[model samples]
Target: MRRRGPTRLGRAAALALAAVIVVTGCTAEPPPPEPQPGRLVGAPAPLDVTEVYLQQRIAAMTLREKLAALVMVHVPGTDAARIRSVLDRYGFGGVIIMGDNVGGPARTVAGLTGALSSEAGLPVLTAIDQEGGIVRRLREDDAAAARELRGLPASAAEQAFRTRAALVAEAGVLINFGIVADVTPDSSSFIRSRTLGESPSAAAERVAAAVRGELGTVLSTLKHFPGHGASPDDSHISIPRSSIGMRAWRATHAVPFRAGIEAGAPLVMMGHLQFDRISPLPASLSPTWVTILRQQLGFDGVIVTDDLLMLQRSGLPEYENPLRNAIRALAAGNDIVLFVLPADPGSVGVDLTGLLDALERAVGDGRLVEARIDASLHRVLSLRRAASGLVEPYVDCGPKCWGESPRSLALADVPPTG
Candidate 1:
């Protein structure tokens, strides 16, 4: 009864006070929403301009032409003429050089690259795995020449890596420095000794530092995505499996990859190991893993698969067919497929035609999406143009290339700092 007595006046005063509070709060503004884990909040999105140009290019290409881009084969021996013929016939977009491909000096490799690029009428991505330590391919018999510099404390490792990158770039081939090898490190681990320590945060930081340090000297590729450190078996001989769950993976193994992506690493190499919690397929063939990489990790670069032939030879019945594996990799978001000759001596028969036919059929059957193909082709072309300056065109030093002029040496020594 007492409250009812002052109803009208009191009610009016209370309403006015409520309005004032609302206005003041509105002007102050609420705090910004907290970003979710793995979300790319402040990062710039990958440009779509390349995708548009690539679509137009692919639309004009024939089935055979598209198939050629999908296959990246190894060149046997140092015979430049034979390599050139293979490249010209297929219009191959790139070559993965191994020990067999390194025949002569820096000048010789440059000459070979120039010849292949000229005949193909397209800038080619000539790459090598000159990862230091036992993986070094360019130098032989000089153990000091192939120094293992992976696991040095971050600062020293980065400087040494930059020097290594500069040297490989000087050799006239783009490099695939093995930034990450998926082997798990135990208490007495020699392999993990090269890795950036056990913690994912530490690993990611070191890898990103290496990428940033090598920015202008060479193109850096972050390999074996989705955390290869957990794999117990070697993919080279068997299909390795990681017992860790997706949650554990996200917290640990995935840390370095996310860091590398944030640093704008131009290329990411997919691993061949399988994670059973997410998908039965290997990371190279799993859409969840690839989609997470592109969308969540904010990586919009070329994704190349670990060699398909290795999967087939891994003693796994499921990987017996390399063509099917290639198709799966494409569907899973990988942009390139590597087919290299085995290190085993006296091996014959590569079966290139079979691989080509399989890829062709996959495209025809819609197993490999046309849009995805265009996206990948555009990335490849962009990388080629960026690396070789194909669009601008530099001096084509024909045969008597070395030391013809001091100017030539000056030009060659200046590295492409992208």
Candidate 2:
């Protein structure tokens, strides 16, 4: 079949269309630059990279996911299956291993961490209260030097803690609840033996060195904030009262906390001690103290409660209910409330699940705002993200996220290495 050629009018029309395209500069925008090879499509970026990404991750999560990030539950066993059941069900930010959880096996913890972390969406921080000396959890390690901070020089103390941290890190543990910053001079002080010891100056130096020793690998924690040694009353039994005034506190007690903060410790566990003169409430449940920790001392990291169960141990009218205490702690600006329920003598017979249930009801009832959950989750996620290597130290502090702290990476968006 013969094909018909374009007529004069058709050719003229085609020429006119070509001229119009050239004049108007219409060209399909160069095929989007050949699809940009090596670009990461849906690869997870750092949580602090953008506010939208962080929020999206937060939004994508269920209430359980958010709650899991907020609490570190203790499942007391070296049995990998029991631990895996908890992690698989809750997706908790961490698992706090007590002395019982650390059986004599060299690789029990490492094996547990590997098994659980492989199934987790984020890094599951392997936690231990390795205070060394009397409170050492990993006694199997010959190099455990938690008690060595008692009288060692700052340089020596730093080396001791750094060595301790390396040994712990080798077990795949990412967090340490050591470095007691409390300075109590009393011989009978409960935490005295576990602390950096008598001199505030020396305590501060030793605490900061220990913090710096871990650098980015392990998240160092300075615990029992606002100093616990001042009160002879045991917080584990009841809410201890610190009779010291704010002026006295500033001069002495606040010293080690300040130094640890300056050294960039990622977590601070607030004590249940009440500074009656300065603040009427327990430090763990007191907004006044939390504010002091944040604004006055400049601790921008995660502030966790010592144990709601301890405050409940007082059996005082205000401290009885674990559910109420969790609410009060959250309302008081605490990012995490440690409820060692069921295991805590004070928490006997109480449902460990009640904490999350109460929090969920509170959020649903508007007693707690979703934003509050988000803010708490942001700090929580930031810590997890930082610890997981998805973000850098204090990523929210710089120009990223516009100086606002937003620490979360979309699990799907994060690169494979993390």
Candidate 3:
């Protein structure tokens, strides 16, 4: 008893040590097994189609060739030879023609489109923002053209939009880029006048009409989703935030987006605005928004971002560099990331090589699932096929111009709806 009493301190220390060991053992876990390489999972296998054919072609292409395909550059002037060189040098997926590109509307369009397709062996997706009112990209002095197009009240905007879509299809552009369609009067109030109507329901109806009109000739893209209407700032200048929460967003901003998708619009453009309620990232790089657009809304169409380079200029610290945003956008389920005319031609803002490299690295490192890549690629190609028609053998228009061709007249009747 005496010896036990004398040894009590030692026994207490031993018990304390045992407790510490037990706690340590309980807290310890084997290090997680090194993650496996990225592999496709939870995504449908690649489908067989003309798109796969093109992707295979792209896959076989050199990095420069692939980079070339990703760009849709603006031509300096109507110089067909210079434009041809750009096409040849870049092998671009398309050309975006602004007002500056037009000389004689019919001649310029036919000549440029023909050159890109025939000489370069690239079927270009010629695109323009032809939304009427102040945003119209196509213009004509003809009274019929002006008379055919009229700006309707918000209540009648749907019918007007349908008519506008029909007119856009007649223009021979493969893609009709709709601008200010998603803005409302109340939120940002900056894009209010450009919007068809103040109410979400009205906007949705008009958007649907626009989609319906483009079913044959051009694929319609309803832009600035999750509502740029709420932002006071232009995304081109700054990353605007929405004061409305996700619930309000679902009720209002999401209305037109749902309508456009339901109308079978093949493409939707993600906005650069940030929605803190949904995500800290810009809507263009948010999985929540993209997932809603794809799964919740049941939109199977391609999701393209509103110019990553533009977002970089908007003073968003995270998005100051576009390469990160590009990777994030694709990861967030955007099929195509547009880097529309960068301020710096030499820099290009987003490094194409860096973007591909990051994607490749993510695939290698198991961060990005291969299935996701394939899904995006599939959607992109499907849209491309839908946009492109049968590849006719090249006929050099040279000086004679394809505008004189009978096929070009098909666009003449496509009247503008103001």
Candidate 4:
């Protein structure tokens, strides 16, 4: 005979017993352990993730795309869609936001940068020259510049840059092409006013402090590397030539760059100045200088060119070809070739596809080793990944993770932006 189902009262009694058991078991389970201080919770280590992601991305990219990813360009305007179109069509790795690009307020600039960063996984590296003196893009950054900070204490440099970096990050910019590392003692020098310090040691101290100040907020770049004080001429119109020997350079110009690099600056902008004693070519296109930077100084971060267009503007026949300059800059070991372009790139003879094609051909004919392209791509992509917030969020270490509350440093006494 088949057993009858439980009676209504019997079923009710059984359900009640099960509910009590469930409640008791639930209460018995312990909550997860608190995330250890200085460690990320429920996430894989960021460095490992970054390495895996970068390799995967590099392997999947076409030769053209890889070449494009090594380029950073600018489209002049506040029109977000127009600027974004250039970045998207070329698959550029970054964009340099100029003064003209910053149309309205910080929030409005944020909207522009937000549009430029369409790729969520690995956003483009949006940079600006918010150096706070003659080179600031944002109007609100009235913090101490090189002229004032050069005389102040090191703490002052740190305080000033901390505020500057905050303002840059607030505008949604990822990288700052600020922190002029060039040191000069010549009162007549063009870079004198822009130099952080009059001497090498003083510049080194302030450069390190500046890097520290920008540590967590944004990626700090030490610009016009190999030192801009080598010559009195501007790089925009002509290549500055210097007669300083290697010993002199290592003693003087290299000090601040080394300090900045050691202090955790992620990118160093190679200047267009020529140290004739070191190498006849500009530092931006000199393998000797690159090797010196990498091996001697132990700089493993991305090395970017000052501006490829500057070479053309020098009125030199050899440097007039934009495509050729980019190739040389890349071959010389620059990880990223920077171009500050106008709205119409064609007017300046900057053909996007032509540049890519030239790079691919160079690799094909062995002018540029495929391995070199791969190496630079690794560096460039690694920076993009880090800037995209993949590494920082997962890792709890490094200067970028410094969670200290900023000290009360007022900027009221600082002069208005020049």
RMSD to true structure for each model, in Å: 16.9, 13.7, 22.6, 16.0
TM-score of 4: 0.82
lDDT tens per residue, model 2, 118-217: 4333566667787667777778655435356565677877777777787677667888887789887787877777778577887898889889886665
Give each model a TM-score.
Answer: 0.75, 0.78, 0.70, 0.82
> Which pairs in model 4 have colliding backbones?
none
Q: Which candidate's TM-score is highest?
A: 4
lDDT of 4 by residue, 99-162 (tens): 8999977788998999887778788989999889888899988999998998999999999999
| Candidate models: Cα lDDT each | 0.66, 0.72, 0.62, 0.83
After superposing candidate 4 on the true structure, give the runs of residues whose Cα lies further than 4 Å from its correct spot: 1-47, 344-349, 391-418
* Residue 6, model 4, lDDT: 29
Q: Which residue runs of candidate 1 sit more than 4 Å off their true CA positions?
A: 1-56, 119-121, 140-151, 181-183, 187-193, 342-350, 390-418
Of candidate 3, the 10-residue stretch with the lowest lDDT total is 396-405
User: On a 0 to 1 TM-score scale, where does candidate 2 land against the true structure?
Assistant: 0.78
lDDT of 3 by residue, 315-371 (tens): 657767766676677778777667665335565465545656766676667665666
Please give the lDDT score for candidate 3: 0.62
Top-down TM-score ranking: 4, 2, 1, 3
Clashing pairs in 1: 182-228, 204-256, 216-417
